[model samples]
Target: MPKPSSISEKPHRSNTSEESCAQRPHQIVIVGGGIAGLEIASNLPKRTGRTSIAVTLIDREPAYVWKPMLHTIAAGTSDVSQQETSYVAQARNRRFVFEPGELKGIDRQGRKVYLSPTEIAGRRVLPERAIDYDTLILAIGSAANDFGTPGVREHCLMIDSRSQAMNFNREVMARILETVTARNTLNIAVVGGGATGVELAAELIQLADVSAYYGAAGLRDQINVTLIESGPNLLGAFPDRVAIAARGRLEELGVTVLTGARVVAAEADCFRLADGRQVSAELKVWAAGVKGADACAKFEGLELTRNNQIVVTPTLQTTVDSRIFAVGDCSSLPVGDAGKPLPPAAQVAHQQASHLIRHLPRWLRGKELPTFTFRDFGSIVSLGGYGAYGSLGQFGLFTGGFLRGRVAQLGHILLYRSYQSQLHGFWRGGLIWLADMINSRVRPRIRIPD
Candidate 1:
């Protein structure tokens, strides 16, 4: 890997249309089309003074989905299509170029990003290529970290992406339809008491209920869900009372909750605990912790943390290269008086994107950048339709109190709506929400993909 140097050198100019004139537009290439990357691409100013700003977004997936809702999609409770925004369409409408490819490598010296060949059904459709950029931003997001546990790669299913979520849904639906006899039970074990695990456990219960309603008889009775947390409580990020409330709700809904039960290994049919006991399950999901993509470590020679996250300054610029920036789950920057790394959450990504949207144009015009400050708006975890809980951290001044029940649930829904409004503008985004409401009334509540 080449070592990163000063970002003063301009990239080699190509005879592309954007550079055909005497003065070329300042090229900005953003890798990853997740929450932060897409927002930055959509909202960035198209021009900085007399020079035009050319932005390009690259990603492996063709469409963008709100990753926080993957659990609902995995349980077949929500339609992925309703939430998906095509990269092609978004780029066209937002005045940016979209390239469908994964980041292969970066040439910091040359200011070029190399992308891997794009494939469809195991065949390559586009050859590997490189794109030059005056500024590069990485927001590829994070993935589940198994902590090197044995058999986890083969035995456990992870819902880090849309395809993975759909794959889990298919297997779950197949198992639900197979439970014809009361003697056979579909046992599921979810490892991780974080928001993903707890929410998925509740969604699974709802999945059983929806399955039975759709003529898959006795699914509720024939399904067993066990939520195992290595910590003493679920939703460890939330307040203790919220965690207690979530645990209580899951228990009341027939979920087996196990706290402080560390998983030693995942076998073909069960999760072996460190205490010499095993929790048997036919389907297993691992959502315990997240780390930046392992592939991120291979990107150029940028500084990385032990978890593979790119290290960035408080301004969101990479420590090694001033022209390169990283945000979202893929980047690590410590803030606050405690100097703790920011938590991996949607709000963090959104705030970072908004920061860049405000500061990048000023940066282009050669102005000093300000440090990015994150305002804590608190966190909310929704357990499908069972209930919701939230704590307003710095935002409590406006709310006047913590939230729960329908009010907290409304807050959860509004977060996604606000995201859509930011991405699609208010009018089109409102139409999208209205369309979803109409679809919910007419379409089947559950999706059993073929």
Candidate 2:
């Protein structure tokens, strides 16, 4: 292995389009190429008059995937290839730079971030390089929290990223086929009753139906799905009635909903409950909880919460440094409800991104920084394509049954489209939407490789 480059070192030139840009303008480095980071790069008031800030968006992956749709990918309802936006392409179009590298460490005093070199097939493709920034924005998302359970890291699957979701989808299909061929029962254990867990459980049920239709035998009856929640009810964040209804729906689908059951240990083939009960499962999915990216907590001199999230003030600036702002799942900011930190949801991230876009330009010009107040617009958890349940605004809990569920589905689809509109202009977004609609009708529902 070669020695890593320092933060001040320049990257070796390649034929890549990102490297072809001649000017090395004043920098505003945005970490994590997720929704929040991409939005910030896209909407950063294109450097006017005396103010010119060249935005450099960095991430481990080369492309940006809308994470809210990961559950759909796990269900084989959405193809990752179709949904992902190439960060390099987007940066070129939007007049920014895109660096595909994993964040290794940060030097706040030096205003620089050390990035690990990217490699492929045991060959170094991109050398370690760093870009100096006047302003640093951390939008790196959270990861599935294992809670230090034994064998979880070695055995369970987490649906945090697009690749993980796709891998799980493939594993699920393969498991269904294997069980069908062997004419044996296949059990799935989902740990966590939050929105992602509940939504994925519902989607897995749908996938079973799809598999049975596509000639995967014994799937309809032999498939056993179990949901384990530490709380007394699923969707604990929602109203009691909503939680009750969701649990009822899960039970109706023949899923074993185990409430107030915590997994103390996990093995390759099974998990041990806190109460000394053992659940046998061929495949395990852990959606239990989330913590900020491990790298975020490692940033030098940054204040972090108990959950390893960056401690940010009301204006979303890091407690140790005003030049650094942390948002999305990586930041811990005060919430109105429960007087605690808000849960890491796509809604909160979208709100933060929008808020920052509105006020960041003013702050960049030595003006007043806007305080971020997160308004609870409420949340809607999709129960696969069957239905959705949750509340809207301050209104009482609303349940979408059948036709209304489709409306909710449209709303969910529009949420990502709205993000796309922010990245690309509305006119271009409309064109993309039309193309996607036409392609959806023509293409197969699931991806098949030749």
Q: Pick the lDDT winner.
A: 1
Clashing pairs in 2: none
Cα lDDT for residue 261, candidate 1: 98
The model with the greatest TM-score is 1
What C-alpha lDDT values do all the predictions have?
0.87, 0.79
Model 1, residue 427: displacement in angstroms? 0.4
Clash pairs detected, candidate 1: none
lDDT tens digits, residue span 46-147, model 1:
424554789999999889889889999898899888778999999988899999998889988777899889999999999999998889999999999999
TM-score per candidate: 0.94, 0.89
Report the C-alpha lDDT of model 2 over 1-450, residue by residue, as the tens digit: 112112223333343622433354456899997778888887774633355568889988777778878887876777777888899889888888888888988877566888998987899998888677767899999998998898999999998887788789898778876788888998999999998899888888877776665566557788889999998889888777667877888889888999999899899899899999999999999999889988876787888887889988788888767778899999998766565887798878888988888877666556667677776666667787667766565534443222235666676677779888988889988888898898899887655423
Q: Which ten residues in a row have the lowest lDDT in candidate 1?
A: 1-10
- Candidate 2: what lDDT? 0.79
Candidate 1 error regions (>4 Å): 1-22, 45-51, 181-183, 396-400
